[model samples]
Target: MAAPPEKKTLRIGVLYEHTQMTDLAGVDILGNMSTKSVNLVATLEPRVSALLPLSTPMEFLYISSTLEPSWTTPDMFVKPTHTYANAPRDLDIIMLGGPDPAAAHEDSITFLKKASKQTKWILTTCTGGMWLARAGVLDGKKATTNRMFVAKHAGEWFPKTEWLDQRWVVADGEFEGAQIWTSGGAGCGESYVSNTR
Candidate 1:
């Protein structure tokens, strides 16, 4: 009998910005897609666990401005494993997540510009889209964000990107290489994950 094929691992870099707990939901679901689904089955049929690959489909590196730890929301706090200066350059997926409408700092914008070149997918939630715009990655792409917020303030922030007023999530570009996934609100991050490969 041959061993199960090694699972392909996706390296995910989730950006941590201030006051944006909802944005984290996007990466959280992707990171758990395999484990969460399989764990339940393994509980029902314990033998199945041994046959399945132990390797996770996704590996996450939380990237933030500091290693000192910070609050993402009123109730959520995260201690990032990697800082912008030290994060791996070759990332499979990069998520610009966090609270909406917050201005992207120079360091974050610089990192996004560099990472976008090598990253396959870029997922942004709520006002996180603003950061991508600042990085110039969404210059010609059709994207969406928190509808209400975008209507009021996004124009000045993301003038280059074609902002849309529609539903929860909108996607542009090919999934195999470079793609942008933008979700409206915090809860919509799940929709972004479900639609993506």
Candidate 2:
């Protein structure tokens, strides 16, 4: 009998600080794409059984500038699994949700600059693209942000980037070999994730 192939784990680094909860909704969908969910679907349908082994297991590392909890709202927050300085270098994906652009920390911007080179994908929701812009990762890249922000400040603030008026933009240029994806305002993240899947 042949042995099963080893499962590949998809490491995702979720960066957050004063992020909007709605912007992070796509992470939940990503969490549901694990091997366990694939098995459940196979059991329920009895089809796609042969494709179950192709599903990659996913691991999410909630990252913050500090070890303390990161607040998404005045009442809600998410604890950090790792700080920017100590996060794993082998992240497959770097995900960011909308946070107050003015409140962005220098450390976070620095981390994004470094991580973008190593990660396969960089995903941003709403104003989260601002951090990438501040990091200079979005410079010369075709990207989009919250529609309101794109119309008002994205162009003026980040003139180097080609800001587009769209629900979301997926730029697959050689950004240190990373594909960048940016989604507009709240709830657009859900559409982005679903379409990407």
Candidate 3:
């Protein structure tokens, strides 16, 4: 009898602080794909052969500068699973949601600069691309952010990056060995994730 395919765990770090929850729609889709409920359904229903869970397992790390809960809005928050200093160094993917550009801390930016070089993929939604630009990873790379932000501030803030006015943009070329995937406003993040899948 042949052996089953090995399942490798995909570690994804979600970097956020004061980020809009809607900006993380794509990550949520990925999470759904990795859920046990879907896997159970796929295994039990032979007739629904098309319904399959992700081939590899997935682990999500909610990262923040500190262990404290990070606010998504005034009343809602997500607790950090790991801090920048202690988070695993070898992550397969790093996901970023739109946060206030000026509110990003130097430590978080530094962590991103290091993570970008080691991670296989960097997915950003809305102003998250701006954070990558702040880390100097997006310089000389073609990326897209929220269209409103692109028109008003992205160009002036990150002149080195070629910002585009699109719903989503994929820069397949390696930026320190990581491919960047960026998307504009709400719901577009989900679109980007669908394309990747």
- Each model's TM-score? 0.83, 0.87, 0.88
Q: What is the lDDT of candidate 3?
A: 0.81
- Predicted candidate 3 versus true structure: per-residue lDDT over 1-197, tens digit per residue: 97767767789899868788888877778876764546766678755435543444789899999989888954688999999888885788888889887778778888987887778888899899898889888888899998898976999998999999988888863545557898888667777665554
Residue lDDT tens for model 1, 59-175: 788887788785678667788898888888678788876454455557777788888777877888777777777788788778777778677677767778888875554555443
Output the TM-score of candidate 3: 0.88
TM-score-better candidate, 1 vs 3: 3
lDDT for model 1: 0.73
TM-score of 2: 0.87
Ranked candidates, highest lDDT first: 2, 3, 1
Instruction: Give the clashing residue pairs of candidate 2, or none.
Output: none
Candidate 2 stretches greater than 4 Å from native: 36-54, 173-177, 194-197
Better-scoring candidate (lDDT), 1 or 3: 3
Q: Find the 10 residues in a row with the least total lDDT in model 1.
A: 167-176
Cand. 2 Cα-lDDT:
0.82
- Give model 1's TM-score versus the native structure: 0.83
> TM-score: which is higher, 1 or 2?
2
Candidate order by decreasing TM-score: 3, 2, 1
Which lDDT value does model 3 have at 108?
A: 83
The runs of at least 3 residues in candidate 1 whose Cα sits more than 4 Å from the true structure, single-residue gaps closed, are: 35-55, 100-102, 168-176
